[model samples]
Target: MELAVDAKPTYEVGARKWLITITVITCAIMELIDTSIVNVAIRQISGNLGATVEETAWVITAYAISNIVIIPLTGFLGDVFGRKNYFTASVILFTVASFMCGFSGSIWTLVAWRFVQGIGGGALLATAQTVLVETFPPEELDKANGIFGAGIVMGPTLGPVLGGYLTDNYSWSWIFYVNIPVGIIAAILSWKFIKGGKKKLSGKIDYWGILALIAGVGSLQMVLEEGERKDWFSSNFIIFFFILAITGIILFIVRELTTKNPVIDLRVLRNRNVAVGSALRFAFGIAIYCSVFLYPVFVQSFLGWNATRTGLLILPSAFLTGMLMGVNGALIKKGISPRILLIFGFGMVITFAYILYRLATPAAGEWEFLWPQLVRGLGFGFIFVPAASLTLAGLKGKDIGQASGLSNMLQLLGGSVGIAALNTYITRRIAAHHADLMSNLSLYSQTSNERMQGIMLQLQANGKTGEQARQMAMGIMNGSLSTQSSILAYSEGFMMIGIICAIILPLVFLAKIKKGEIADIGGAH
Candidate 1:
């Protein structure tokens, strides 16, 4: 797989430059927001569409699978059709699909449209990042990345908020409808203003590579998304797909390495910075998204917070982190080592994790989560921008698209894998905790006997028969045991995640640190 290095060039400075930046980033954010936006609306959607909760989950799974599968292919698509045309086409596809998704009468129809939306949406992200990279000179890459990074950070954080509000105030369909106008505007701007990143006729398309990608990534994503509900390896569906995922991925890797004119270049991993940086990005994805996955469920499931309240609680901190991404970029350009920034970032994550572990309980209120969420946002701000800088620091012009695509793909998969693993961990831990707590609640303990006697006496005073009151007291104890077990499991999960961060911290020091550059960038034409 050979890279075609285009001569470095720059667009004329002025209104057009900033306009392109705004257009690309808006489209990027819009696509990203859709990724998580549907999460808060699943219950409403299932009820309205007359689908089972299990069936409605296909809407999310379809989008997620198609999105990750197409991400690494965006670079090749851009090279074939030209980035401007490909991007504009993507936006138009997403917009139309969103409209269709809103109006669909059946659950499968909505899921089909969602898959189409994901294809377009996936293209927008890495392609937009590459376009943003080409817009600025190398010296200003930090500022450029700052702008791009902000969108990535805000999109997921804002998704649940926007979705919750729309679903609560109007209807679930409005979530899809909301993207229509933004999509139209972004498509128009991209067609009229975006430039560069086009290539001449290339070798035969890597058809097998593409299929392998779909089979491998699609199957793996399915396994991750549905595994917990289906009981993992115990389910035949999970077992079949797990086998497909491993076999398909093995084939895909081999095909990419051996093919001339590969669908997505595998050779970029040869760069030390790019390789190490990609691993770090995957770790960061788990750290960021697992918390996002854990917090809402833990609060809603155990703490009894509503979806909207949980969304709002996480919002302020997410916004703070978005702003801090820009600052962290500038600091990198000012000679602060990315390694140092990463260490600080991981330290904050560990700190946030520790606090969350200690604070989580069934009786904990919303306010207890505030400062920890804030610190997490701050940590992400420090981590994201600098990591991007280090990843592509060694790549030539032709390699940027491929590197960006691969990096983004890894991040997405990491999040999926992390969410699945964390959930399974909590489930097993909860069972163990329940068993231990059950032992303590037995009549063998003096305190247990006293508590039961008190409950029985209180119930009897409320006019219940003695036997009925005793039975009710036992029920209350069982309920308390279950609740306490769940809370303990979540707390332990948080500490385990923190330990994982601490273990991966050494990778930051191993990443190559390149001095910031100020070279001109070529347009995507």
Candidate 2:
């Protein structure tokens, strides 16, 4: 995937540069926000569309499968079509799909449109990063990265907040509807401000490689997104896809490496920094996304908090991450070792997970999460800027697109795997804890008998017959047991994330890049 380079280039200056920055970052954030915004609106959407909650989940699954499928292909797409033209078309495509999604009369229709939207959204993210990289000179590359990193951090954080407000006040459709105006403006700005890449593919298109990528990544994403819901390998549907995922991935690796003109250049992983950096990003995705995924659900389901309130509680942490993006970027530009920053960052992530594990009780409130969330923000800020810098630091020109595409794809895949694994773990833990608690509460236990008696007496005093009181007492005991089991399971889940981060933290030492090398790309001042 070699792209031709110009002998001399012109850079956007003054207000023009800032305008381009805002345009690309806003588009990037918009695409990312769509990734999780629908989560909070699932129930409402199901009700409105006359579909079961289980059926409605395909709305999310479809988008994720298509998004990951297209991400690594963006470099090839951009090389064939001009970057600016491809970007504008993607914005327009996303806008149209969102509109169609809002008006869909059936769940499957919405899912179909969402798949289209994911293709566009995936293109927007990878292309936007490449544009930002080329927008500023190497010396100011950190600034461009800081801005893009801020969007990446803040987009998912803000998704639920905006989705909750719109869903609670208006309707579920409004969540998709809100993107129309933003998309229109972004599309116009993209075409006007972004530069065109003149490079075109000189060899035959690798159609076989493209199909293998779709089969491999799309099936794997489906397996991750739907495996637990479908009972994992117990379900024949999941078993088939799991096998396909493995087979397709193996075929893809072989096809890409052996093909003369591969859709995605697998050879870039030969670079040590790029390889280690991609691994770090994969772990970072798990850490960042698992926390975001679990916290709101825990608060809303167990603590009786509303979606909006939970999202609001997370706002401070999101802002802290955004602020830290610039700080970390500047620190890296000033020759601070990325390895040191990475170690400190992973340590904070471990600390955040442990603190949350300790606090994962039914009684924990908003205040308990405040300090820990700030620590998580620090973890994200530190990890993101330096990880991105280190990943692309060793590459220039065509390699930049290839490495960034692969890096982003790995991160998203990591999130998918983390969410699935944690979900399954929590389910199994809940069952185990429930069985242990039940065994101790048998009729032979004096403590269980006394507790049941006390509950029956209380029910009798509240105007229940003897038999009724006994039944009510039994129900109350079971309810308490179930709730306790859930809390314990969630606590274990948090610790699992911490352990994963700790295991991967050692990889930072393996990523070697000189100070200021990230800023020294293409020899531009």
Candidate 3:
């Protein structure tokens, strides 16, 4: 249990370091779970608040956009305000916003509070890693990263399960309300025990970079979230924002590269491992994030499962993933090649996706998802921890903050993009399938005629007129057709995710990380 004599100490060593770790990890998990917890409650929110699905989506979109805008700014803000002060302040803001979000009577009111919550939430995510790396000795940073990766995987994995149980058993507001007590305890611990560090604040503010970042990231998020709603590029709304995304991104890059004090240092990507690791991270984001989003919606919408069942279906896999984090951490400490783990993880990911694709159906029960999801759980366990260690292995000091910010920001952006794109794909696929199925439905078709006749007779026997019975029968038929189309679309979507993940397999071998270099990082302190 003893650290080496010459190890660097950012705070008091031993007991306090572990306490600080627990405090920040608790807050980080709270913030992260909030990102996806509301997903299962969208229906309850819209019904209670009288908001349409489109209007209610803003609840999710607003939070996502805010996270994108604020994440990269965290390093800069931490330097201006002491890290502990900024971190403690963020916990207060997030907790208060959570309290307010639970009580909002209107959809827009909830959206506004969620946006504020995301601002605080984004800070916790960006700064918590910095604290972890600083808390442990340099060689033990991989162990720190293993612990940090647990929160990342667990938060999103458990969010829907917790959200579903709360929504079905209590009310949707409980999702937000649940954060209040936990947030208060975390804030108190973080403030009282965690040490604060202040940076020498002398750099000129990069206002242009800040502005460009806001415009670029904000516009890009808006485009992805709203593209399907507006019919994509066909709408003038989509076209205008596309221009802003491109122009703003260009300007942001130019400003950051030229500025004396950049808000986020883009130059970090020039490193070989950092650059390749980022792309793989982004791909990892799309794979895990998109599958989680798609699988739940598929079961809920087509299979007639309640929120609770849908959430529970994936619970085992997530827990398996969390348990594996420690397992991988042990492996990393043993100097096992991260490349081998990553390749194995990616292989499992491909396997998980393909299995899900093969097994997905309108009638899939919880048992059907059990094994595939477990494979996914194992796959993520290998993928997340090692991918993170490899990407961050080369960074030191201030660059760690900037790299962490950039890596975290890209993953968030990647998740949002994946959700948006997959949703759009499902929408289009459903429409096409629906049209194709409709073309085959006819009174002259024997199977269609008998099914319609049986439905019509049942409705008539229940006291409907002939015309009413006919209308009801058609309604039933159309509903069934829509469900079938949606189920097929989701299956294809899962297969597509598998293919995309498989394409990234080559990156595992190409990774610049050597086993010895990463091993030194673990014991170097």
**Model 3's TM-score against the true structure:** 0.93
Candidate 3: how large is its RMSD? 3.8
- Clashes counted in candidate 2 amount to 0
Alpha-carbon lDDT of model 3: 0.83
lDDT, residue 225, model 2:
94
Candidate order (lDDT) = 2, 1, 3
TM-score of each: 0.96, 0.98, 0.93
Model 1 Cα shift for residue 44 (angstroms): 1.5
Tell me the tens digit of each residue's lDDT in model 3 across 59-148.
Answer: 988888888899889988877787889999999999999999999999999999999999999999888987787677666767788788
What are the per-residue Cα lDDT tens digits for candidate 2 across 316-425?
98899899889988898889988988899889989999999999898898889888889999888888888888888857667888888999899889889999999999
Model 3 worst lDDT window (10 residues): 1-10
lDDT of each: 0.86, 0.88, 0.83
Q: Highest lDDT: which candidate? A: 2
Residue pairs that clash (backbone atoms under 3 angstroms), model 3: 139-521, 139-522
Per-candidate Cα RMSD to the true structure, in Å, reads: 1.9, 1.6, 3.8
Candidate 1 global Cα RMSD: 1.9
Give the clash total for candidate 1. 7
Clashes of each: 7, 0, 2
